[model samples]
Target: MKGRTVVLDHIQGREAAALMVDGILEDFLIASDAPPIGTIYRARADRPVKGQGGMFLTTPDGPAFLRQVKGLAPGVQLLVQVTGFAEPGKALPVTNRILFKSRYAIVTPDAPGLNISRSIRDEDERDRLLEIAHDQMQGCDYGLILRSCCHGADDADIAEDVSAMRAQAEQVMLDPGTEPETLCDGDAPHVLAWRDWTDPAEVATAAGSFETHGVLDALDVASGIVEPLPAGASLFIQPTRALVAVDVNTGSDTSLAAGTKANFACAKALPRALRVRGLGGQITLDLAPMPKKDRKGFESALRSAFKTDLDETILAGWTPLGHFELQRKRGRVPLAEVLK
Candidate 1:
């Protein structure tokens, strides 16, 4: 709907730092302060619940499990936290929790009673997938985070991806690939396009095409493009973790608000401000911290902007910082990426 920037953080030695900024996206930056490790998620292993083995952690980014399976060996059980290692040409243990190294979670089942439990029309195909997973499991136990591509994927597709991975691992023995080299990747850019299409806010600005210079139309959030900004309407974009400040200069004729009018204007335009400025995430409006008489009007402006007609989304009360706060939904991308 609005023109925004999404900065994706990659992983570093101990932190993640990647930034994806999209101001219409033709001129975009997928900058990284570190490695492109993607997002980290918390997961709980559900099936074949083991008392001794490790628990699987599934995040939006990838799949990792904490192994304590050896505790089943009787006597005093030892709960082991295994951070898996990938070695070329080395056989994996049955107890090892080896997952596809990726930025997204795509787990499949390999252990007894933990295989894909869903019914399938083709028994042979299902058995084949399970067998493939079993073979990959090798020496010890393992868990798989099967990607979405696994859905309706023939045995060949899985075999190709998995085999490609295995072959790449073998190549590492002859000549190791660069750490930054692509090992496994997720869905294509068009899939991302489809996700943005479902949201209704992504293309809200551009009815025609994006300009050759890469400036998109003024955004309308969920609606459509409002009115296009006249040429020479300078836009200054400032981004913060919680809020984004967009200073719009309406040229010489524009008048600065004297009293409560400014607060009222801001309140009235907050929703559109969020949309056009791509200002989602945790947001707080400072508004110069106006006087008590103007406070009610400012709060009223915020209430009007929510568009949901519910009190659940807006925090109408004052805050400790003397600024009014608005808890809006986090957008697909961030503001800094767009603004930058």
Candidate 2:
């Protein structure tokens, strides 16, 4: 099993929280004030502009835009989920597709039917999960999407999680009179990190603040301290707005064989670093040149390493200059902006 640990640090004198996994800084977010992503909000359609195909909404957090409105008129109240966070001079994006996330799965109250996770490639396991979901969904109007964590879970465990999510969805659906502009907050970033990246049962909390828990040291390592790898190797991670570029550098004293070994090691470690840094979107890896025949083996190893990531990641093949390109879905806020 891959050993994982989570650390939540309340940075002194800052209005943000830092999350570390396995002693590596992964996510940092503004505490409390950040826009709640999965929170369900009761909002009223303020005015529908005929020029635009959507309507404006007035929510408790503020105004939001509904890109599509089907016969929705002004002053119409409905339940909407926070789809995206608000940007500077921009409003949050809301959608009618409501979703409730539990420990093991996501429940879509208005979805057409049940859908299983695509990451579970094992045919037998997928079929088994589908059977379990079908059993739990009986008499329930909503649908469920089994998360990655549900891969090895028993039917009873899946049933319990689904039941809890069903209850939440039911309460929201029954409360059509919920006050407008009110929201039901979802899980926090740290909680989500722990749940998705590490086992909640294995989490150990420290009594003092982050400074006392060696979180700052981890942050320092993430910031710039490149750890020495086998054969005197190091990695330089450069993150830009377009993509993250990781450069593998070997010591001058390293032999050719040792350098190639280090390159392979770097390729294996790169994915974990990306996940811990929360560096999503496009990525490019520049490694020491190796034989053309060996490239395929290296790529295959990289693919295997990335499969462990919770978010969807796509390997876009190699470039003419021997740079490896990849794309990860922007499922969460970038660590750079979060820390800034």
- lDDT of candidate 2 over 77-117, digit per residue (tens): 89988765554466677888888887787888878588888
- Cα lDDT tens digits for candidate 1, 205-278: 22223332133332212123221224323333355644644344343334444334445555555554454443
**Model 2 clashing-pair count:** 0
Candidates in order, TM-scores: namely 0.34, 0.70
After the best TM-score superposition of candidate 2, give how far the Cα of residue 238 lies from its true spot, in angstroms: 1.8
Model 2 alpha-carbon miss at residue 14, Å: 7.4
Cα-based lDDT at residue 121, candidate 1: 42
Poorly placed runs, candidate 2 (over 4 Å): 1-4, 13-33, 41-97, 112-138, 145-160, 173-182, 197-201, 209-213, 225-228
Q: What Cα-based lDDT does every candidate model obtain? A: 0.38, 0.71
Best by TM-score: 2
